[model samples]
Target: MDCLAGSARAVPRWRNVAGASRTGKPVIVPGLIVANVAVFVLTVVTAGSLNRNFASPWFAEGALVPALVANGEYWRIVTSGFLHVGPLHLAFNMFALWIIGREVETVLGRARFVAVYGVSLLGGAAAVMLLSNPLGPTAGASGAVFGLMGALFVLLRRLKLPAGQVIGVIALNVVISFTIPQISWQGHLGGLVFGAAVTAALVYPGAVAQNRRRVQIVAISGLALLGLLLIGAGAAFL
Candidate 1:
C-alpha cells in the first residue's frame, strides 16, 4: 500500500550525547528487517506465490481492515505494518528502512528509535482506518519508514545541518504517493507528521537540560494518546 521508491542520501551531523550511549552495533533495525522478511516468507508460502499473498489467511487475519477494526480486531494496526503485498513492496519499504532507520537509531539510540517507529506505525494505521475504505485492505512498513524520514529531517535540523535533501526526498515521495496506483497517501502523511512531531519532542530536549528524559517520555506518550484517539475516531466513523 505504499510506493516507497528510491533512497535518500544521509544528512551529516555529529553524534549527540544521547547517541553516545549507544555502546555497540545497532540490533533493532536489523531485527526489524529480519522480522519483516520472515513474515513475508510465511505469507508467500501460505499463498503459494509471491504475488498472491494478499489472498492468504494471513492477510485476512492481519492486514488493516477498517471494518474488522471496528469489529474489535484492533491488532491489525500493529500487524499490518509488518505485512506487504509482494516482493517489490517489501523490498522498497525495507530498503528505505535500512537507509533511514540506522541513522535514526544511531542518533536516538535503540529505545527512543523504537518509540518513534512504534508511534509512527500506529499513526499510519490510525490514518488509514480513518481515511481509507472500510472494507479495503492496506498493509506495509512504508508508514513506519516514512516516519524515519521525518525523524532524520528533524534531527538534521536540530544539529543546524542542511536539511533540504530530506525535504526533497519527502516531497518526491509525496508526489509518488499521489501518482502511484495503490499507494496509501494517508498513511504516508500521518507518519510524516507524527514522526516529525515526536522526534522534535525527543531531540529538542536540550543536552544539559534537567528532566530531559522525563519531558521526552511525556511528549511521546501524549502523541501516542492522540494517535489512539484518531484510531477511535476512525472506528466511530465506520
Candidate 2:
C-alpha cells in the first residue's frame, strides 16, 4: 500500500538556542520504525504465518473492524496502524516511513510530528470505518505514511520550495491506490486530507504572528479536538 518515489533536498540550517547550527536528526522517526518492526515480528511469532486471515487472533484483536470498533474495541483504530497483513505490507510501509518520516519529524519537531501522525492514523481508521465494508478488516501504515507525505507537501509549499516531485509522487500513489486490489483508498484519501488540514493549521498561523510557537500549539490542539469529534461521530454512525 506504500512506495517511496520522491526526494527532498536539505534546507538551510537554523541556529539553535545556543547559537549553534544543528542538522536536527530525527529521533521519533527511528523509534516509530522500530516499534512497527517489533510489532510485525511479534505478530509473525504469535500467529506463525504472514497470510491474510481475519480469524487470526492478531487481526481479530488489533485490525480495524468497524463493527468491533463501534462495539467498544475503539483501540483498534490506533492499533491497526501498527498491524500488517503480511511481510510485503510491512516492508512497503516501513520503507515509505523511513523515506519521509525523518524529514517531517525534523521540520515539525518531535511533538508536532507525533501529533500529525497520530491524527492521520485515526483519520484513516475513521474513513475506513465510515466508507469501507463494515465487516471487512483493514490493517497497515499506509494511511500514516500518506499523512507524512501530505504534511511534507504542505511544508514545502509554505516554504516556497519546489514541490513538483512531491506532487507527482502523491498523484502516482493515489492512482495506485485505486488500481490495486485490496488497497484501502478511503484510508489513503482520508489521511491525506486530514494531514494537510492539520499541518496547515499548525503552520499557517505562524505566517503572520510573532508568537508562532504558541499559535502552533493552540492550532494543533484545536485540530486534534476536531479530529476526535469527527472520529467519534464516524464510530457512532457506523
Candidate 3:
C-alpha cells in the first residue's frame, strides 16, 4: 500500500489514474444491449403462431429462471439480460445505459467499467441465487444497470461532480421501483450495493495517510457490512 508522501493530512491530492491496465480499453459494454436485442429478435421469430410460446427451446425458457442457472444453465442468467419480453423493456434499459455508461467509462477508463459492470452482474446473480425459487424465471439488465448507478454515484463523488444532479437521478429510479411489477427489485438492489462497494475500493485505495486511510477503510468496510446484511435480509425473505 503506497502511503501518501510526508503529510498525513488531506486526500492525497486526488490523483485519478486511468485505472489498471488489466481492463485494456474501456470495452463498450454493448454486450448487455446487443445480447438483449438478439434474444428478443429470436424470441419474436420463434414465437411462431404459439403467441408467446418462445420457451419451447430449453435455452429460451431458461433465461428468467434461476434453478436452471445453478443446474448448469448458468449462461442464461448473464444472457437473459440481453433478451426482453418486449420492446419497451429493452428500450428503457438500453436508454439508461446510453445516458450513464459513457461518463463512468470515461472516469474509470474502459478497464474499470468492465470490472464494475461484470462484478455487478455477479452480484445480481447472487441475489437470484438466494431468493429465486427453483427454476424461477428471471430476466432484465436492471440489476447490472443498477450496479452502474452505484458505480456512477461513487465516481461522481470521487471526482466532486455536482451532487444535486446525480442524486436526483438515483432517487427517480428508486421511485420507479414502486410503480413497476416484475421489476426484480432484488437484483437491482443487490447490484447497486455491490457496484458502489467495488467502486469505493478502487477509488480509495488505502495507501494514504491516517484520516484518508481511515475514511477509505470505513467506506470499504461499510460496503462489506451492507453486503452481509443484504445477504441476510435476502435469505430471510427466501
After superposition, candidate 3 runs with Cα above 4 Å error: 1-27, 49-61, 133-135, 208-238
Whole-model Cα lDDT of every candidate shown, in order:
0.84, 0.77, 0.63
Candidate that beats the other on lDDT, 1 or 2, i.e. the better one? 1
Q: Arrange candidates by TM-score, highest first: which order?
A: 1, 2, 3
Error of 1 at 206 (Å): 6.7
Pick by TM-score: 1 or 3, better one:
1
Task: Write model 1 residue lDDT over 182-213, tens digit each, in one string.
Answer: 89998998898889889998978654556778
lDDT ranking from best to worst?
1, 2, 3
What are the per-model C-alpha RMSD values against the true structure? 5.1, 4.4, 7.2
Clashing pairs in 3: 26-110, 36-82, 64-137, 64-138, 65-136, 65-137, 65-138
**Which ranges in model 1 have alpha carbons more than 4 Å from their true place?**
1-20, 206-208
Q: Tell me the deviation in Å of residue 143 in model 1.
A: 0.6
**Candidate achieving the largest lDDT:** 1
The candidate with the higher TM-score, 2 or 3, is 2
What's each prediction's TM-score?
0.91, 0.87, 0.72
Which lDDT tens digits does candidate 3 get at residues 22-86?
33323476655676667676776676522363453633654756555545565665676665656
